[model samples]
Target: MDTTMITIVERLAWTSVQTALLVGLVWAVCRLVPSLGAATRCRLWWLVSLQAVAGLFWAQPLQLAVLPAPALAADTFIAGTDVAYAHAPALPTAQVVSAIHTVSSAAIGAAPWWALVLAALWISGVLAMAWRTAAEWRRTRALLAAAQPCADQTLVEALNLAAEAHGLRRAPRLWMSAQIDAPQVVGPLRPVLLLPAGARALQGDALDLALTHELQHLQRHDLQWGLLPAVAQHLFFFHPLLCLAVREYAQAREEAVDAAVVEGRSERRQDYGRLLLQLGVMPRPHLGVASAAPSTASLKRRLLSLQQRHACPKAVAVALTVAVLAIGVLPMRLVAAPPPPAPPAAPAAPRAPVPPAPPSAPAAPPALAVPPATDLPAAPPAPAAPAAPAKVQEKTTSTTTIMRSSDDDSLSMITHGELDLGKRPDRAYVLLDGNASYAHGAMDDVKQARRDLGADSQAFWFRQGTERYVVRDRTLLLQMQEAYADAARIGTEQAKLGRQQGELGRRTGEQARAVAMVAREEALRAVRHSTDINRDAAAEAARASLEASRAAKDARGNAELATLAQRQASLGAEQAALGQRQSQAHARAAREAEKIMAQALQDGRAQRL
Candidate 1:
């Protein structure tokens, strides 16, 4: 695994841990002050997710986020210095060279087996989600394609009023979609309120309330803020705490929106809840949209939260502040104090002072000395050699065209070209006109393909409503499928066969009933058309004839079944006789071979003699 990826995984792991701890702190605060507002909890959950991401990979450490330049140290800090040992002399050259080293990796010893497993799992999940998110986006586009601006100007006016109430800078576009069963907010930028066709029929202030609910989502920028938990959850899909945190975040977000929706119209809490139930839950884009329908996971929390007071108590606020600061922000500035200054080095002994007087001869005083390589100055480096772009985006496209020369059209050779998409991912490659390698397809054709390919991607047919941050979770779907599979698996082959047989018998009975009803109806119609006199007699005759015909057919069927059984028995007897004759032939052949061998031995003896 790459070191960068390991570092990322490490941060994600710690982030999950930190988020979990923060969640606990919030939980504790909520426990102490159960009256905490939904809005407050919503904010806290948002913070937990944000704190996780901000403190981890996306941002710099708060401790070092901003710092002034350090002043230069006054003296060389020597090692081995001693105040108690008065005889110890100081050495000036023995200064501490450096404190910081070129070691950054946090993992020690051999990388664990699990790290490798997680490394492989890391990008796989991200790609899987990317694919899923794209698919969802395509569906959302198709769903929105059918949606047009609502004709009801009344609703439009109400939407504007709701937008004003929510203090939105720009009101969302109101459109009605036949594809959706409930109202939802779509698009992060240039948001649109997509309502079901049934939403127009909402009574009294119901329309306004619903519009307010969706507008609140836009106001809080819930669609964008919601993506945080989703993204973090997507990265740490296997982290149980992260999942819990995301779930908490989602419910809190919805409840917060609900609270905002009924702020002025507090009496309509029940009406709002009724409206929620009436709208119910429907399949909607979980990747990009903030659905207005309360999901099953959070529905209870949202309904209960409606009655809770919005006013936050000061004590509870203080506790939350302390918890968030302690759990989230306090560690940002925590740095280990610089290592204790090194002791001064010991002085060398003053021994051979008198021996320095020995005479020294001046030998070959000076052979010409050459300067070492280090003495020569380095050649001046090349100036201003331009660096290639960190990434190059060059696309070669070959286009074939048909041209008219004089009078007739002629096919031209392919021409290649490139379009500059500046300052993007920098190394993007797109293979357009995939229609060549991939066959042209339509909606019906794709549907047919899906029907054919449905069994291929079956995970196991299982997973849910989700936020924009992470891809959706499929645990519940999988659980249901596994439960069904378990039940089906528990049955014996004989039992399954018997059950299928019973089902077939029931279907046959139903078919017979349908046939009888059709014949009876025909008879009644014949009677209805019969002229005055012998109508009753004719009807009776017709009924008798039908019964007799049915009895005869059943008798014929029984006779055929008996004949088939007899034929099967005769075949079985023939098989047994053939087996007996085959065994007899094998015995006769063995005896003949033994006799031939004895005669051959006798002939060999005669030849030897």
Candidate 2:
């Protein structure tokens, strides 16, 4: 299988095992302590679930150890031993050489079908559970929308009283709904206390008790505890222990809420017990809501605990809470298994020591004639010649045939149908191996040849048997020296080229950075310019508005002044008309008076006459 897929499968299995172990630990702790508040226990479950889920993302193993393979003793045999022993050989030289050059390949397998199936099943379960949770939440939301504010003033007062008694900063909103069976608290931040329609008719004390129970949940923030465990339970629906732990968490949470409500209020404990018993018959709260009452068994336990006033001590509760938290976090550290043990080492066999070679016989002295004894006696009589000085000579041996190449007149060893030079000459190459000694010996032989056979020598002594050949070609030595000089030149050029390339790269990078900086500066300038333009535009708009307002005020004042002037002109025209009328009336009055006076005079005159 694909190693990646196999590793994924292994990690999934390990995480599942870790989660199971953690859940069991949680379950056992909850069962043992019973005093660790539901909130604390719920938090522990959440921690373990998170740790398990987090383990999936942990790509590295907890511990990695390289278990080396055991060393095996290599089979040893002498070369050409089969010929000596008259037996078949292990392998041909060519076959062994080819085997050394061979490379190994591996086939990759496909992912197993079962792993895919398991993954698909897990995904499907999660989806199904998620859908269920969503649908229930939707139902709860619909029910919440249908609920109406409680019309009873007494219940509202009781809710406020209970909240203030519990030291709640803000009283939760209270509503009455006919859809819900039991009183449950919903919403974490702005909590809502939902009461059944039947609760409307409940006695004042029972209503107070129920309100107090649900309010205790709100005050303690138990509604927020169910969310993580619910998600964990849904995701790991396959694990029975997780399901049990979730159920236990819910029960413990309700108990904790119950204890908080009736802790100090001894007188109301009976009423609270009765309220729980009454609500216990109702359907359980929706998964999205935190009910004031749990199952019948849990209700009985709550009632008994309330009656007995059984409560966890603060110190004990704190200690257990810390311990449980440690348990939850421990799995994350210990999830990885230890690496396998290394294999034992194999013992090596002892090798046989090789025998040393025997010493060579002394060389025979050159023969001299007997007549030479008579002649030599006279020659010896001339004078015992001074003994010659000994010369140091280097010994050489050959393991293959030595051939002289006509093209280059260079000596080469013939081995296994191939000519092998003592060493391949490379430019500026220093011989650091036995080849250096061979070259030094050859140079010494050439020096001796030049000293003994004149400085214009063209060839050196060539031994035809198991002895070394001395190279004496002046052209070859000169060519070798030239090659070394060329190699040194090439090395220097390469170094110079590398330096140039590095410099060029540095310059290019600097130029790129400079261009980027310039672009940034240009962008900043554009942005500043745009900001300035916008600011000027806003300022101009404000100025125009100010000018327009001033002009409008001026226009209003001019209109008011013109209206006053027109009113004054109308008043003046009315006055002038009034004066003319008055004058006409006075003239008419005078005319009438004159006529009356004339009449009066005429009458008087006629009477007198």
Candidate 3:
């Protein structure tokens, strides 16, 4: 996986979390709060889907430390100052150095073989889901094709009357088809009301209730607004929380509509309840559609919500709405809490003081070389000191070979074959802040951080588990100033190029359009009156009509030529506009790069970095 895919996965994970939280919170509110009416509860539950969508597109990472950080394992610590302990025993290992290098490259990308396999598996699952949904849609369309106008005039009249009562200007296209048992409204844009062919045999009021239910769906704009979640459920078919959200909202929507159907009618309430139970039990199409509420476990909740008629207190409703909105803007995350301060070391037991032994000529100080400074020229002159081995630097005590710097001939250290001490000191890089470590041999600060130093300021440390390696040499910041200069030069050139192109195109377009206009006027003159080309028609009788016919034909041809020229001018103008936008983009890129460099240098760390 690349950086793009990593970012996408992170955003998806966060959005899924947001959906779960919204569903959990809203579910609690609906169950616990009885005063809130059906309409208010529906709105609250709708936030689950809405917030999910919003978070997916715009939520930024807001990591919070909510748990304790884990402890790190102890590793071998290499001290390169002394030669006596240089021959540390190697730990048991499973792989060669070359194989470790290969693994390191994969780690650099933060991807493994399993990541690619999982991504491919998810794509296959989505494709399979899409295929199933398409099959259902095709079957529904086939039913729609076979449907026809109902022969029962009374049922048709009832559908129309129900629509009128629901305040619809025109009822949806009504049809009867034996293909479906329950009445379903399909397609938002030219919606069709699909009723069973055996509708005349059932109670007229039952069908009437179904019609009113679907009409309320229309009046509330349920089908149109629902398209997002309806498609989203299938797209993220594996996600549990999003599925629950869609189902919960559907139940609330149905109960809200049911309340509307029963409003103030004491007798119709019992009949509406029967209609709901009847529809819930009937086996219909299993297509993942948003036209109706789900069945089975959800039916009981829907019925319960229907019986409750008390409106929510205004203050409580406002407070909960505000709370939901706050969740959208205020962010949180589950992050490891900061580690506790290490306990002070245990007090050492009292010991008798021992007299210090006389140092044998004080082991001669190691011959360490000063690293090259930033101000030095690219090709610094070699030092005048003769290249000769000194007595103090010689490896007389340790049998291991001692390595000396080729350029300076000053550094003297035992070669243990653990570090890049063969050809040169291990060259590592760090950010200008001196806190974050970068890849070995990196010349710039923009590279991603490989490790964080925190307060441990050791220039080199040993990592035990894999290969024992050291990070000893710290390289200075690279020649970014020169690179930035080159970018600025290019931006300046682009600015000049853009101005020249835009001006040329603008003038050319203007001239072409003006010429086209002149040609059109000349063509009009030729048609309205005889110009020099058609002057022969003024006196002659028979040839006059023939010349007029030629004039009209020529006029049409000239008009078309003028139109072509106008189109060409328009194209020229578009080219000019594109050139200007390109120039702006180059300038913006140059400025952004400059700002980053300036920020990094603000603390003067770049000089020492």
Report lDDT per candidate: 0.49, 0.49, 0.51
List pairs with backbone clashes in candidate 3: 67-337
List the lowest-lDDT window of 10 residues for candidate 2.
Answer: 374-383
**Alpha-carbon RMSD, candidate 3:** 37.1
Stretches off by above 4 angstroms in model 2 are 1-12, 30-109, 152-154, 157-169, 198-200, 290-294, 308-312, 333-609
Candidates in order, TM-scores: namely 0.46, 0.47, 0.48
lDDT (10s digit) by residue, model 1, range 462-527: 001110011112442233233323222222222343344344334434433444454455444433
| Model with the higher lDDT, candidate 1 or 3 | 3
Off by over 4 Å in 1: 58-117, 198-201, 287-294, 314-326, 329-609
Q: What CA root-mean-square deviation does each model show from the true structure?
A: 46.9, 50.2, 37.1
lDDT of 3 by residue, 265-285 (tens): 767877877776776644334
Total backbone clashes of candidate 2, pairs 3 or more residues apart or in separate chains: 0
Q: Relative to the unseen true structure, what is the C-alpha lDDT of residue 555 in candidate 2, on a scale of 0 to 100? A: 34
